[model samples]
Target: MSEARKLLVLVGSPRRDGNTAMLAEGVQRGAAASGTQATLRFADDYITDFLRDCRTCRRSDGECAISDRFRTLFLEDFLPADGVVFCTPIYWYGMSGQTKTFFDRTFCYYAGSYPQSEEVLEAMCRKRIGLVLASEETYPGAALGIIHQIQEFSRYTHSEFVGTVGGIGNRRGEVAHDPRDPMRGAERLGREMFTRHYADYRADTPRSTGVWCG
Candidate 1:
């Protein structure tokens, strides 16, 4: 039997028991059912400060010394994951501040000139996949805008843009009422992608290019 895939799920919602979490939980359930080894990382659990724009990551070493919880997660977990699921709630027509800061802190992993280290690039190019989960009430348009940001992140970071799940009009576990909710879709997307590209996964999907798992 093939070894199970290592999956990393990042939850970016401030509300631990909100709709976003509910959707994330569904995705987690689907992944677990597929026999994939999954890890859940919550951004709210870790207190992080704003990233001071000092351009410290621009040096040849390309490392950030902001001294926060982000540093610990990067060194210990995120960098080694086979795939990533990004779950966040839309706020102010964009992703939550917590999620945004997480992206900002990724600077600590690379060099200043943005020279893509082979390992980082490989992580992006190889088994990397992105899943976005967002929630909105009447104004789901904002959620669409936020998803663009996630797509941009995928392109820039060399991660594969698998797909996105937008849960609208449903608060709490209302999304669960819909059998075909985005959360379930997100989980299935992860499993399908892993299955299709199990052995010879390609990361040469190119950066700054638009690709969707639709």
Candidate 2:
């Protein structure tokens, strides 16, 4: 039998058991049921330092200069995964600070500052990416920024941007009661993360007229 696929879920929410966490848990369960090995990492627990300067304390081996738990997590858990899901609660119409910081630190790998940049890029090209967002606002545009960012990230890495799940909630465990039932959508996204291929709208269709559909 072929080896099972690996999925790394990076939760950028500070709350341990909040609305965002609930959506992530649903993803984990569905991924597990689909025979994918899903690993969840809370960003607040591992990522401590914000990336200030890539050249300040640059390592000779081309690794991130900042000394933090994220270094190990990126090298061991993230780089090897077949798929990656970024789960965050929307903050001020954007991704959470933790999520943005994580992406900012990844500049080293894609900027050719890393010794194994070619290999890392190759791995990224083969992976699939997904987004999970939790927001208090039911407004359609609330999660748009996060979605666009992830979509562009996937394009830059040459990875497939599978899709997204946006959960509307504020209180702890409130997402479970969202009328839209985003928990189920999160689960569906997880199950299809590795198998689904979304066509690029820019390449396959006419430019959008900025109309809000959701």
**lDDT of all the models against the reference?**
0.66, 0.86
Query: Residue-wise lDDT of candidate 1 within 102-210, one digit each (tens)?
Result: 8776654553344455665555544466556555465657677777776677677666666667776356766566555666676676566456432224687444443
Clashing pairs in 1: 58-112, 125-203
Candidate 1, number of clashes: 2
RMSD of 2: 4.6
Clashes of 2: 0
Off by over 4 Å in 1: 54-63, 113-125, 138-140, 178-180, 196-214
Q: What's each prediction's TM-score?
A: 0.75, 0.89
lDDT of 2 by residue, 1-214 (tens): 9999999988999998999888998899889999999999998887888876667767887777676888767778899999999999999999999999988877667667778878767766757999999998989998888899988888887888888898888789999999889999999988888877566666567766664545
Off by over 4 Å in 2: 201-214
